[model samples]
Target: MRMMLKAVVLWGALAVAAGFASIGAVHAADKAGSKIEVQKSKSPTTQKAKARPVSKASSSQRVAQKGKVASRVSKAKSTRVAKASPSAARVGGSKSSRPTQKGKNVAPAMAGGVDLWQGQEHLAVRSGSALVIAQDGGEALYEKNARIVVPIASITKVMTAMVVLDSMPNLQAPITITDEDVDYLKGSRSRLQVGSVITREMALLLALMSSENRAANALGRHYPGGLPAFIVAMNRKAASLGMSRTHFADPTGLTSNNVSTAHDLARMVAAAYRYPLIREFSTTPGATAEVKGRELEYRNTNQLVKSPTWEIGLSKTGYIQEAGKCLVMQARVADRPVVIVLLDSSGKQTRIGDANRIKRWMESASASGKATPA
Candidate 1:
């Protein structure tokens, strides 16, 4: 009986041991499944973290493109501004327009009549002293330092002729070119040789058309009180014409002391235009003179006078180192009578260019009914 009981106890202990081993295996499998799930969730988190760098790079590229676009837009705006401004337009006479190197700065005057203002595109002149006025009422249309004083080289001849005519001198009187008529100051060459003889009318014509210093000197020398009296008369005439800023030291205009403002020159031009003799002489494009039995052909000093495109009533050109190229004229432009004065120009062609620019600007302004100020 004892032996059978011991065997039963041993069998019971083996069955319990097997049941514990099975339970332990199930617990280990559950722990392994939980670890796998945690690893799977961590894989998605790592992928999301890797994708963030690419998103940041794309954002940086978008910002860079925006900056480039803004730069292009700014450049376009700058170009437009430059095109609309006249400050970029070249101004100065000679080969180019230069700003005033000497002289007091004067404020620009307002355009008062007919309002013919063409913006900077119309009146880029190199002359330091300039003016444009309507002949009908003497209204200033455009001006640049018009009130400033400056030397007017052969422009003195206009006043000299006026004084000669006002004195009622014989137009047919004989005027001889002598050593006294030679330009001693500026050493300017003259086509009329010493002892050349011509009628007073011819001398006047040569003086106005060819800008002959000798002819002008002869005219002044024969005046009522001689050359001294002639100079006094010129000042008197300028004063009478309200040319407050004008003065003349000689009729030849070789002296730098012969000075006048553009405004005063415009007035002088207007006064001279009324004289039939001056109008005829100054506007003559070409003429021939007999000097020592040789017929010498002389052309007008003003180039515009020879152009068929210009209907100049009165014209004069004057030049000296002190006084750059100078010109004054009364012309019919845009169907209106106008006076133009250019002074202290630097270039040989700048004055003519300025006149053409004014003409084109005036025509365009009249057509469009918009006048721009220079």
Candidate 2:
């Protein structure tokens, strides 16, 4: 797989020189988009990311088998990564250009308050953000702006969880941080600094629970075969997981180039829930733990963590100006498994509102289904 990824990188570079983006251009406007730790290739996680393409949905493949773009609106037309991204190369962009998935499921809006007043105000707000709901064999319920990739803030940790868990055989291994790990190319939020050594388990916890940028960087740099190899693995893992519509330019979401749509993230969340550790870490409301012999307390970012009604197994939240307030979760709605993704919300409350609306949508859908005859 590593050898195959190297070959693909070579091919992609050649393809790029020939006048097309091997991957979608990483936009320059969002600097905080590059901070997820589970993205670096050359390590075990990268290897996991490489195989992700194997499970791809044939109907949603935007790129041709020839590895070329088919249309401007669909398949992420061959836009130059350099031209499209004024944002300088981050961690994963230079690696394999593993195309992401396409074809998101979408739901239509019923008549507004005038129709029946399904308690819209109390259930959720009207933020108009894009949302995706997945349940029962990964079918989509509602989709908006599910295709226009944008910055994804700390939510990049979802990939971090996937890649790190799959690549590292020894989860208990300790990874040390360097000065470079904490420092940002642009500006990024971080409480950790150089010379801090923490176990892979702890690092994963810090990155997901506290949204620590330093923890994310250290994990990538410490990855075997170095940064380039780490990136290759992320792309590969994404491909194997059938997440062709998603791409990782950096380990951290601190770079503007880290873009994804709500539907793509839903695909990611569905996969992340498969991991027990990921499910626990993302949903834990608060953790009073020790790191590096120092007592450190951390809590889940999603405000709903304390709510008993969520019934969430996994959850994550993210934000960057370009990405807006973003969120995704695996939960039980209407007594069944369901995944939700909300992106580019107007404000903090919008994501919550989106969640409420989804719950209501599920209830309404279930009710409507019962009313109809087989």
> What are the per-residue Cα lDDT tens digits for candidate 2 across 1-374?
99999999999888876544423344322332443333343456666667666545453453454344345434343344422331221223442332211322223222211111122222343433456454433334455556676778778888977887888547688788887776446677555556667788888887777777788777777677776776677778778777777778767787767777666677778888888998888877877656567777788888887787778888888877777788888888766676777777776688887787777766675565521111
Query: lDDT by residue for model 1 over 1-374, one digit each (tens)?
Result: 99999899888888788778777787777778888888888989888899999999899889889888888899888655544433331222122321222332222223333333235333566677778887653446677788889999988889988999999988999999999999888889998999999999999999999999899999999988798988899999999999998889999788899999988888899999999989889999899888898999999988888888888999999999999999999998877788999899898888888888878867777667564332
Error of 2 at 5 (Å): 99
Model 1 residue runs over 4 Å out of place are 1-114, 118-122, 371-374
TM match of model 1 to true structure:
0.70
Global lDDT of model 1: 0.81
Candidate 2 accuracy as lDDT: 0.65
Q: Candidate 2: deviation at residue 68, Å?
A: 53
- Per-candidate count of clashing residue pairs (backbone under 3 Å): 15, 46
